[model samples]
Target chain A: NAGVTQTPKFQVLKTGQSMTLQCAQDMNHNSMYWYRQDPGMGLRLIYYSASEGTTDKGEVPNGYNVSRSTTEDFPLRLLSAAPSQTSVYFCASSERLTVYGYTFGSGTRLTVV
Target chain B: DQQVKQNSPSLSVQEGRISILNCDYTNSMFDYFLWYKKYPAEGPTFLISISSIKDKNEDGRFTVFLNKSAKHLSLHIVPSQPGDSAVYFCAASDTMNYGGSQGNLIFGKGTKLSVKP
Candidate 1:
C-alpha cells in the first residue's frame, strides 16, 4: 500500500501564480504535515493537521495554506508563488501522538521564477 | 534561532572504515532524537534514534550515541559501504512539550556522507 503519495513531482510556476500540491496516505494517519527543504536550511514545517478539519501553522506558514478534508488527503496550497517559495516539498503523516516517526512522500520539486 | 545543528556540511570515509556524523541541539527539552538518510530526489528515511534516558542504542552496524549533558548526539556506521553514501539528517523532538501526537521535529542541516570504494 502507498504509505504516502504526493502529486506533480515537478512543477515550475511564474511569480504570482497559484497551485496546489496534493498529498494522500492510505495508512489512515490522523496527522499530516507539509515541509519545505532548502539548501542548508533543512526541512521547515509550513503547516500541519492534527486530524481532518483541523489545521495549524508551523515555523514557516506564510504564503501557504493547508486543509485536511479527509484522513487520507491533505493538500498544500500556494496562494502566490514567489521565488522564495522554490524548494522541495515533502508531505508526511503519522498516527496522532505517535513517536515512531513520520512516513514521508517522495517529494515535489517546485520552482517559482 | 536554529535548534538543531549539524556543523559539518559533508563527510568522506573509505570503505571498511568508521563514519561518525555529529549533531548538536540547543533545546534542553528535546529528549528524543533520530537520524534519517536521504538520496537525491527521495524523501528521508529513519535510520536510528536515541532517547535522553539512554546513552547509546545500536542496531547491526549502525549505532547512535546520545550525550544529554552535552546536548550532542552522533551516528556511527562501522565498516562503511558505498551504499551508505547519502545525506544524513539529525532530528529531535520534545515528547514532553509537543507530545507524541504532535511530533513536530526540529531538523538540522544535513551532512552528506560519501564512502569511497
Candidate 2:
C-alpha cells in the first residue's frame, strides 16, 4: 500500500499564480499535516487536520489554505504565490499522537519566481 | 523565538564509531520529544522518541536520552555506518487545553550528520 503520496512532485509558478498541492494517505490515519521546509529552517507547520471535515491553522498559515474533505485526502491551496513561497512541501499522517510516528510523503518542490 | 534548538549545525564521525547529536528546548511544558532523520529529496523519518517521565529509550542501535531538568535531549548511534549520514531534527510536543488536543510539534534547525567510511 502507498503509505502517503503527494502529487506534482515539482512545479514552477510565477508571482500571483495559484496552485494546489494534493496529499493522500492509504493508512486511514486521523491526523494529517502540511509543512514547508526552507533553507536553514527545519520544517514549519502550514496547516493541519485532526480528522475529516476539520482544519486548523498552524504556525505558518499566512498564505495557505487547507481542506480535509475525506479521511484520506487533505489538499493545500495557494491563492497567490510569491517568491517567498518557494520551498519543499511535505504531507504527513499519523494514527495518533502518542502511539504512532508520522508517515511523510516524498515532498513537492515548488519554485515561485 | 524558536522553542527548540540544535546548536550544532553539522557533525562528522568515522564509521563504526559512536555518534551523538544534541538538542535543547526552552519550553518546560514539553512532555514528548522525538528525533527524525532526513535524506536529500526525501521526507524526514522518525528515528526515536522519549517521554518526559523516562530518561532513556533504546531501539536497536539508536538510543534517545532525555534530561528534563536541563531541558536537553540527545540521540546516540553506536557503530555508526555511512548509511547513517543524514540531517537529524529534534521536535517537542506538549498538551494543550483547546479541545484537549495534544499540542503540535515545535522543531529545531536540524544537524547534518556525516558518517565517514
Candidate 3:
C-alpha cells in the first residue's frame, strides 16, 4: 500500500500564481495533516482534517486552504503564492490523535519566485 | 515563542559510539513526546515515543528518556551506525484549548546526526 503519496514532487511558481498540492493515503486513517518545513525550522502545521468533511486551521494556515472531501484525500491549495511559501511541504496521516504516529509522504518541494 | 527546542543544530559521532540528541519543552501541558527521523528529500518518520506517565521507553538500540521535572527529553542511540545519519526532530502533543479539538503537535528544529563509520 502507498502509505501516503504526494503529487508534483517539485514545482516552480511565479509570485501570485496558485497551485494545489495533492495528498492521498491508503491507510484509511481518520486524521490527515499538511505541514511545511522551512530550512532551519521545524515542520509547522498548515492545516489538518480530523475526518472526512471536516477541516481546521493550524499554526500556519494563512495563505493556504484545505479540503477533505473523502477519507483518502486531503489537498492543500495556495490561493496566491508568495516567496515565503517556498518550502518543503509534507502530508501525513494517523489512525488516531494520541496513540498512533503519523505516516508522512515524501515531501513536495515548492519554489515560489 | 517556540515551545519545543533542539538547541544543537547538528552532532557527529564515531561508529559504535553512543549518539545522544536532546530536546526541551517549555509547555507543561504536553503529555506525549515523540522523535522522528528524516532523510534528505523525504518526510520525517516516527522513531520512538514516550508518554508522560513513563520516564523512559526503550526499543532496540534507541531509547527515549523523559524528565518531567526539567521538561527535557533525550534520545540515545547506542552503537551508532553510518545508516543512522539523518535529522532528528522532537515533537510534543497537547490538548486543544476548546471545542474538543484533537491535540496538535509542536515540533522542534531538527538536529542533523552524522554517524561516521
Which pairs of residues collide in candidate 2?
A: none
> For candidate 2, what's the TM-score of chain A, rounded to 2 decimals?
0.95
Candidate 1 reaches a DockQ of 0.59
lDDT of 3 by residue, B54-99 (tens): 9999999999999999999999999899999999999988754311
- Order the candidates by lDDT, highest first: 3, 1, 2
Report the lDDT tens digits of candidate 2 across residue range A18-74: 999999999879989999999888898898888889888888999899998899999
Candidate 3 colliding pairs, count: 0
- CA displacement after TM-score superposition, residue A73 of candidate 3 (Å): 0.7
Task: Point out the higher-scoring one by lDDT: 1 or 2.
Answer: 1
- Give DockQ for candidates 1 onward, in order: 0.59, 0.57, 0.62
Cα lDDT, model 2, residue B53: 90
What docking class should model 3 receive?
medium
lDDT of each: 0.91, 0.90, 0.91
Candidate structures ordered by DockQ, highest first: 3, 1, 2
Model 1 lDDT per residue over B50-83, tens place? 8899999999999999988899999999989999
What is the number of backbone collisions in each predicted candidate, taken in the order shown? 2, 0, 0
lDDT of 3 by residue, A6-109 (tens): 99999999999999999999988998999999988899988888889999888898999999999999999999999999999999999865435799999999
